[model samples]
Target: MGCALSGPGVTPEPTFSKEKRGLDLSEETECAETPEPLHLSEPQKALIRESWKILHKDIARVGVIVFVRLFETHPECKDVFFQFRDIDDLQQLKMSKELQAHSLRVMSFIEKSVARLDQVEKLEHLAFELGRSHFRYKAPPKYYEYIGAQFIQAVQPILKEHWTPEVEKAWESLFKYLTATMRRGFYTEEKTAGSGGKSPCSRKAGAGSTPNKI
Candidate 1:
């Protein structure tokens, strides 16, 4: 459930002005206003749950394969991880216990997320908190998209027979939902940190608003 990979060190930038803040959050605000932003249906939920049951058995392998593929396809990503940064050989890196452990942790988070499919609010909260934590860890949301795609690739063969267009769509929808909320949380933290520990947007929204909850 923790940060799946290390992020580059971040030095906070200057806070936005009133007009600038509006500009900064305009897209995020638009996304937030959209109803059923995830587009996940009950049938999609069922497909995700069923596929997960099969995928979970090879969780460890899937986890390792995911990151390895990530490093292969996006070699720059490896530089973010302090532990793996120096390791040039993908084959050698594969055997490292550190990679295995962290990869497993990421998968475990996926496990919990699958279990929370029926509780939409809880699921969103979980992803949001993780995103906030990533902000602290200096993990940019840009890399989040890569992980979901890598995960899908890693699990396809494991569920070779069970893998279907429907299942793929379901998982893709889930990742989309998670990444969207996570992006919101990341921006929320960034705004708060940049503005001397208070988010200007949330202040305008008042107490107990969606921004505050995120």
Candidate 2:
């Protein structure tokens, strides 16, 4: 299974009660009229692929750091996971079996996507499907930006001698594609669901098979 970021504050407010949801773009969410497809050059792919090789090897330890930083950035996200929900201790949440499993799951998704960077369509499809799944979580485009940021912050130290601007840009490109495609899938599903306001968690599928919180 891959990662879902456990959308900490992602309950769509209008439809649900006060306790639900989140977005990445922060302010406005009017989907772009002509959302550009995020693309990567051969060199860019090479940079990302090689760089990821260094990071994935230590994903168990590094993945925890990523989630820790992620929750610290959005403490509200702690409530999204049943494991961490209502817990007062930050370290406890960080070390819980749930966080460990979930964070690693999320990393696996990252790993799968990174491995396919060379296959642009394949990569896009991965994002497309990921977006479709995330639509259920009510996660907004901006969260992609957040996830990408934490991923780098967590992996930079592990990469030590290798992290660079170019590598960061490559990861950014991948996140852009993921954000755009996910929004596309989410909105499309939302439109099709109409005012019926179906909860994404109602159906079980893919990596995030548990609840649709994140």
Candidate 3:
């Protein structure tokens, strides 16, 4: 997996309370418009897995495309990355080693998430922790949804005929589930840190914040 600069404070391993473990996929769907629980049937899972196999071959390019598109559509997000915040040139960013490494970290996280679909609890835990880490990184949950949408747009051309509505729905459901869990984690950390919420840890020269892995 790729690595990025972590936020200053130390984050503990996530714990699953009885109530938290019992939460169904839909329980975290923070969308007011659609409160439906997340439902990914066997066929949908299979569709995502199969499509991922084809996309994985171009994971690097896709990762770059996803983030580039994200920055293009949501320029404010660039502010969250210390290493990238000052760089106004989008084309130069595509070639940065930091961007490449960060992209790999994100793609690796997605790969792991896809592998864990059969294990719901594990998948939830993974995403939850990622959110907690993001809190330290100062990357809010609002930007999480954009990554998924950009990923879909980046891969649709590669998936071509295989990119059916069902496939799209499956990916969307998975992202929604992940982002919802992530949001829960973000709030949990926020509450734990209390008001002011600045990290107790010291900062490093190039330590930039990102949403990919802890």
TM-score of each: 0.78, 0.73, 0.74
Off by over 4 Å in 1: 1-36, 203-214
lDDT per residue (tens digit) for residues 73-93 in model 2: 777556556556666677887
Rank by TM-score, descending? 1, 3, 2
Best by lDDT: 3
- Higher-lDDT candidate among 2 and 3? 3
What's the C-alpha lDDT at position 179 in model 3? 72
The full ranking of all candidates by lDDT, starting with the best, is 3, 1, 2
Native-vs-model 1 lDDT?
0.69
What overall lDDT goes with each candidate model?
A: 0.69, 0.62, 0.69
User: What is every candidate's alpha-carbon RMSD to the true fold?
Assistant: 8.5, 8.7, 12.9
Work out how many backbone clashes candidate 1 has.
0
Better model by TM-score: candidate 1 vs candidate 2: 1
TM-score attained by model 1: 0.78
Cα lDDT tens digits for candidate 3, 1-214: 1111111122222432222223212222121122113468888889999999999999999999999998999887777777877788999999888888899999999999999887766676678778778867767666777888888889999999989888988898778777766665665665557546653322221122221221
Name the 10 consecutive residues with the lowest summed lDDT in model 2: 205-214
TM-score of 3: 0.74
Location of the lowest summed lDDT over 10 successive residues in candidate 1? 205-214
lDDT of 1 at 23: 26
